[model samples]
Target chain A: MSHATRRNILKTGIFFACCGVPHTRAALAWSMSADPLPVKQVADGVFAFAGAPAMMTRQNEGEICNVGFIIGDDSVAVIDSGGSVVEGKALIGAIRAKTDRPVRYLINTHMHPDHLFGNAAFKSSGATVVGHHNLPRALESRGTYYLQSYREAMGDDLMADIRIVPPTKLITDEEDLDIGNRKLTLRAWKAAHTDNDLSVFDHKTGVLFTGDLCFIDHLPTIDGSLLGWIAQLDILNGIKAKFAVPGHGAVPSPWPQALEAERRYFDVLASDIRRAIADGVPMTNAVKSAAQRERANWKLFDEYNQRNAIAAFAELEWE
Target chain B: MFATIQLRNPLVAVVLFAFFGSAISSSAWAQNADSPESTTWSSLKGDVFGQKFIEPANGIVSIEAPKRAEDAAIVPIDLHFKTDAASGRIKTVTLIVDENPSPVAAVFRFGVDAGVTHLATRLRVNAYSYVRAIAETEDGKLRMTETFVKASGGCSAPAMKNSDEALANLGKMKLRVFSSKSSGMEPMTRATEMQLMIRHPNNSGLQMDQVTRYYIPAHFIQGLIVSQGNRLIMSMEGGISISEDPNFRFEFDAKPGEDVKVEASDTEGKKFQDEWPLASSSL
Candidate 1:
């Protein structure tokens, strides 16, 4: 069965519980009412272009994320790991079936738990994990909390059984690794999606693992300073890649378009936060107002919608 | 025969056990305030650490913590002691975070724990009360002062994030060593300040999971040990208020070049250790 069909089957099975979230459940049931993990071959060498099956359509809903592969000579370098280790291992098993080529190098675009938490499975295979230097510290700082949350949220099986080992390697500004004659350039961007977000560029396939820095359909999560994130997007817009795999949502053709969409989200967030500040609303009310206006555009609006507005005002008005 | 029969009944046995458990924990702090065992500032005294805190009529230790804090989770406290004495005889200084539901937060012992007799650190104050500091004197008399801080409902401040995941990085330790600012003035004592950023939830277990309504069990850093190339750099005894992800900074007897390693463990049986090869970085 296809990945989206599987995830949708899994999500549909779990939707009854997810419906508990307020405001966006109906829309999610409408958009993702059917199969979501549709594995379309977007690029020449890539397969299984999966989209995120939103529990609720806040902003980043329709924007499904993809977990595809590039067949290398001796081994394979899977672009990004799915959200949880359960999903990660499933993809790894599928990849293992495709080619006996070692699932050699697992490249994480950033330090977000959704991307790096599954390192242990690959670690057992002795796959060398790589990311920017700050990724380890970021993961170290928040890793404990994420485990506790998962244990409590999903269940003990997912967290208790899995050991969270961080990326073994760290790169400062930029570095290149030869994966089967293909030179993949790992470039570090300034604090945008996070203090450390690294994009992996393939000279062979030209796939850029943009991480959370580039989201196609899903509303981008702004953990880094929004102003700083906008500037980083400008830098990302300059890079050349055939396809960009976002932290969440659809896999799209390179440069400027996905970057532009992300830049627009921040622009909207900034203007709204600015208006709230200009109206002399206190932080809480200002955030409330920002959320009401933003709910229409972004997915996951129920989850991080308020958080972004609150964080934006804190960075701009207070800081 | 009737009393023996009462003990054997399972329902009766459960009630009796419940009564004792509730009486032991509940009565310790939940009694009438007018009672003698009331957990107030006046309740604590004596050299709890068995150290000389202050000499009689020699100095003043004032607290520079917020009367009310921004984040009850992390409150900044500055302990500034008068250093007018020709010889600083502060054998030891202890912080008593009284009035918190958990009472004693944490304590710092100074041996190489030297300074102008002044120091600053942050802690989590779970409630409003007078935080007492007992400075033991070389002359064996302990002088005490108190600071009244208002912080309410902290032990329950939403376990920071999901717990099991946070525990994964529990023992991951970060050591940052730096140079002393008072290099020119203090020719006698060489002190370098080092900060230990430990990864721990330090959860007091008072928090509730919003969705499940279940109480989160307590998990905190019970012990933290720091050493500089085999030379002991004092171990810290921590409690609930060590704050989540516990950060500690203090002056220690170290030169510009000394390798410092920090080893720590949490209540959950997880250990994290890291070493910082000291550099000539400006403190």
Candidate 2:
């Protein structure tokens, strides 16, 4: 067998032998039912679950975004929680199967519901939730609405224990977190995908967790400033990282190259909106036809492209 | 608190019916005749109009809105008014989104001889509801037209995208005058189109501050008046249902070389005013 498995088995045996107590039946049953989510070890000691590109529905249990955890010498740091508490529990189970380290931090990349809905699952672990400084305000504005609105799509069962858990630790600009020997650099970005966009970089493994900042396969949504997102493309391309865990795409993708498709889509969307604004086309008409050429290239293009166009039209009209 | 009460209160329900009647008749109302769709409007009609007879629009006024809202926060509404001596000139038009916390989005009054023909603006639709335009003509007749708009669900709420950015440029205004392009217009019937955009969050006050546990008080442009060289063009009494960065576009007969002046005030008692020299019609 593998060395880590053998070591874990030995550690379990020692705990039972020394303490004279085994896991209770209920605890065992709970662990069995909450099977760990299938994850791939992209880098050494770093595991990620690449979510399917689909809407958050009851069938999928809201597992529609990338979520993962990193194991360090002393403790573990979860990059994002999932779209629902059930997914969050499965992630916790995955971390347990890998190591018996304490979870020190639960880092959220932004305030989007799909990225941070599983926050309540980390509450029992007492992991200090960390997010961008503006996250609290964003949540305060939309958290209740999110909880009420997602009920119909996600069902009552999956949302039962979900809570809008704001981060206790807020990163204003840049902060260094040491999860044992590993040092993670967290940076707060200006309004891009959303006002509270934050990114996490692991120094040891060179994995960057770009919450919703970078989208692939799925069309890039523009809930924030279109110009701001376009303006930051060069800087985001220059971010030093070997691999990136996009908010909604293949996890641990090769950095810089991972940002290519979204960059082009943003450029195309911006130029179309700019041209429409210059031509005196009303926002309603301009949004319907913006970026139609890129429709075939991305998932959920029809569902989101028009919405992005609406936001882009509003932003570009000021120019 | 206001939103919850609005749903159950008969007064608001009556106010919503005028708009909802045009929207629900096609989908939800057909399946169940006894649904709230019927009662909500029947009960609400009296409260809004109050003993005044309302009639369906017969080419007097018409409205255009997306069948399904692409973005709930910024649904566009288009309105057109026909000028005829029999129907008389429309003096006032009330825009309402039935399901919003406040059903009356805005009440727009046109100038006596302004000859305003077309108006367009954006709104924040809180739910699937009927968007209606009720026009009061000078001949003492009320003409109404409405359309249903399905709310764009999932992650898209009727909230500000960037609150900080919105606040940073609050009260800033921009006015753009579209040059007349259609050559078929008669000299006396030619109307110049101008779009006025204001930068404001137009906060709905539904959002609660977690730390303080109190609702963020509503802050929106409550009043606006646009005039050309001391001649009134249009005035509006707005509400929170209006989208952030309130925008209005209208086509009206213009007197060449007149300066267009706009004055507005918000709920917070802040007044903002600006004037632009109207471009000569020859351009």
Candidate 3:
């Protein structure tokens, strides 16, 4: 093992001992009889489990990441997992209720906690976990922090079974997974929502899983590069798909058009920040006025817009 | 006999006061809606500066901090000092975050040759507090200015950089001096402006370790001393309010080729020292 991986393992060991929580492997197994998660059949053989459109809270149990599963003639290919072990178990139950076939692959579209924390629920299912090549590094750096924050935000009862589960198979550029009779195309993009963002395309159903990349109603968070995200949107718009499933908000949004609102928000943010920099406006003033034009268009504008502006200014100021 | 009678009549006094006192307090609260429950600047000045006389700085000393911080952990604050109205030289500047765990964030002492002071640095404001800047003149007169910042949880916010990555390059220091006269096209002039940055995590005790899931012990730069040829220019006592990589920018009068020395110590009692030769010109 690499030295960093070894160190991370040691840290994980220490973390488990310190928190007094059981290792993920010792947790409960995935059962077909568990309560099934509610899902909508967005297309033939494609099921989407839409989560609450609000921020994570104790009431929602961090179930704010949309998850889906693509069933083929013989097996199932699970898209992004839910936010918690309960949600993951519910997803497994939902899959079992629809098809008795074994899960062939578990794909994580990104390394965000809301999309990957539920991987522990499918650990016993004998399905290989897959994600972008940078996902493991991102997880190693941020997993512990996210876990603690969620525990404090949602409490121990709600976050009890959640664990940072890294993917076993890494996708660098693109890969196609064959699940019996279906082929799922997975593409990993440049630093956008995060450095490890990925998307999945179901060839049979023409449904695209744009995890956290396409937000319908929610204000897009700028954790990665603003410029990179805008560039990725250009590429995402060109993909041919009948419907798109976003990481958050409503599923099965019309392709290409679903990306407009988010694209506009990012475009305005970049332009405004560039103008602020050119005008020699200070960071404090830029935070308030950079993205004021889009204030009425997005939810949580007050909470995240200033932060986005600040991040953009910091990045663009040096350029 | 009089004490006993007074004690016995306590119930009558309580009955009479309750009817009149409660009504007056409610009306007083309604009138002061804008000013919240926190202690006012006048009281904070007394508590922090003690009996020291403070004169209002009529735009002589100004503080620029975000009215509403984007990131509470790293709120950039700029302090400018113009010697136009001052009777004497600027000696010391103290930064105070009135509501932080440790209100006295830093105290900066300047040498006689320190030119028109313009300082820009980052601070971590723990709560919604008035960030006050107090400057003491060479004649022992003090002038103060303050700005109300709306931010919270800065001290507890996790460090943006990973702990291991931060620790790997601990104590690495960088010094860049910018001279106003050297606009790249102009000839060399007396270089005065300097920006010194020290690499330290400055972890607050509030942030939990992402891996171990425990409060990462607070380890920050506790003391910083800057000197020019053994002459003490400035020294700062920092707390959680200082950002991870403690950075300071100010203008001081120093001759070209003079060695600018810096020494800092962290909470763990480790000492780091670095020295840079001031460049005569920017070209």
Candidate 4:
């Protein structure tokens, strides 16, 4: 049997009950619904939805990340699925309202739960899942952990239908897919935002779906390599795209300009951490004030900045 | 009764045991707030210390961990040790993460005359748990101190950020020496601070394969010894709970010209050894 099918069976099997209660409620109290996420026409034949700048919860139905679709003459290609199956269904609803074209491809920008938990919702759409070549391995290591940990915040009801689905079509470097007359180019990147970051460039409209690579208002998280991300900035900027749809923040941001805030944040964090390392400061103490100067500029600064600093400090200490 | 339940259906019994553990940790501690007689500690004391009378840490030793871990996989834990006329000197210290799979994170033994004062390290906390430090002083008394940490959803935060890179540079070591900043340093042997970094994945092996779905076997550094010219400074018997690239920052008395050496061996039997010369007047 295929991996997805096997996992699907286990998800509903008797052993699942052995894992115990689905979840116990935490502090946050948000009433969530599975309404179709609102989307906007970012460019010609491109529609994107800007998710909330908050942690994924049942109230938001895990709609805390940008997910959208590109409509070609023959079919539609999705950029990412939201954080929950409910949000994923809402995304499909938004797609159906836009065009009657068949959903041919569901491209995951990365392996983060906010972007891929909705993969199960696209099963009936007959969309062949696509992602970075490293997506499967990354999912294998972290998929179970995501399922177990998110259950507490997302609750049992919303998490019931969530399943980890790996991509069938993997992007090694760059590959182009044709949907009628439109040519969409998919480029797989190194370890930056994640090890399996894949960005899609809609050739005809000049709209680049820079998934997680470019965070605008939301603070960029560092789960991959800090030095690798900094080294690839010039290469990411070299992509010739007029408009860009980031993984989070403004649905349709201006190209290259959208990269400024995150780049500066990384620079400030790296320099401060380097100074701390040079001064022989401990990781715990150094991360406390790594990027405190940028506190006023971004949303969810307190939620993710220190976490980013901790990861960056560990990575940069090897330098 | 416990053995009967285990024999009936090991899987179900295991699940129920885990369920009750979490429930006890969540509810009992929530209401009482780190009572000395909590069920987890009550039962753990017998299993670890074997009915010995344990005393509260009235300033003999202290543990500091983040109240809320930002990243669960690398929660920083700092331990400070003090020796007075009453409690002579600390000989060994055991670190435990109450709610982790392998609760006994590490057993660290210190040299009798090392005069180690402060030790800092990192750990992987799996749930909302209590991180405890049990110190065995020269008088053979057990003194314990613990801190409650609120961390959840760490499963997404795998210890290994770049797994391939972590494997590629396995066994790499770096030793950094910091200038002593504290007063009251022994005139003959000045107090010194040093940080040791080792590159290893320290994988928990709880992750399942994408294809076969079988869990990857646990692999981690099992033993570590740090010495200054044959006089042992510290040694650790560690488990999977240690974070990837195990990092340790510590302060101890230095004999000036002796070479500091580190020897570590992992589960795979791969041994790593490195040494650095200590300057005669290391500030």
Tens digits of per-residue lDDT, candidate 3, B212-248, equal 8776677999999988886777788888778777878
Going through the candidates in order, what is chain B's TM-score? 0.67, 0.85, 0.76, 0.85
- Candidate 3: TM-score? 0.62
Q: What is the DockQ of each candidate?
A: 0.03, 0.33, 0.06, 0.24
Candidate closest to the true structure, highest DockQ: 2
Using Cα atoms with residue i matched to residue i, what is each candidate's TM-score against the true structure?
A: 0.50, 0.88, 0.62, 0.87
- What tens digits encode model 3's per-residue C-alpha lDDT throughout A52-163? 6555655565677799999998889899778777678767866765677888899998877778778888888888999988777667645654665454335556566788
If chain B of candidate 4 is superposed on the true chain B, what is its TM-score? 0.85
Instruction: Quote the RMSD, in angstroms, for model 2.
Output: 7.5
Best by TM-score: 2
Model 2 scores a C-alpha lDDT of: 0.82
Give candidate 4 misplaced runs (Cα > 4 Å): A1-35, B1-29, B32-38, B152-156, B182-187, B210-213
Per-residue lDDT of candidate 4, residues B1-283 (tens digit): 1111121344543443444354344221333323323456666778889989989877788999987778877899999998787888998999998767788999999997888999999998876578999999888899999998666332246456778788999999999999877756664567789999999999988776766978888889999999999899999999988999999999998888889999999999999999999986664
Residue A20 in candidate 1 has what lDDT? 29
- TM-score-superior candidate, 1 or 4: 4
Q: Per-residue lDDT tens digits of candidate 1, residues A1-319?
A: 2435655566434433432222234333333322322334445555444556342111222123456556666777766565555556645654543455676778777755556555665655567877777666555544554544233223334554455566777888999887677677888777776666887777776677677788766666665557778767667887877767666665565565767666767887888888866554444456656746556666656545555664565456532
Q: Global lDDT for candidate 3?
A: 0.71
The residue ranges of model 3 lying beyond 4 angstroms of the native Cα positions read A1-34, B1-112, B115-118, B122-283
Error of 4 at B67 (Å): 0.5
- The alpha-carbon lDDT assigned to residue B131 of candidate 4 equals 90
* Model 2, position A131: C-alpha lDDT score: 94
Model 2 chain A: lowest-lDDT 10 consecutive positions: A1-10
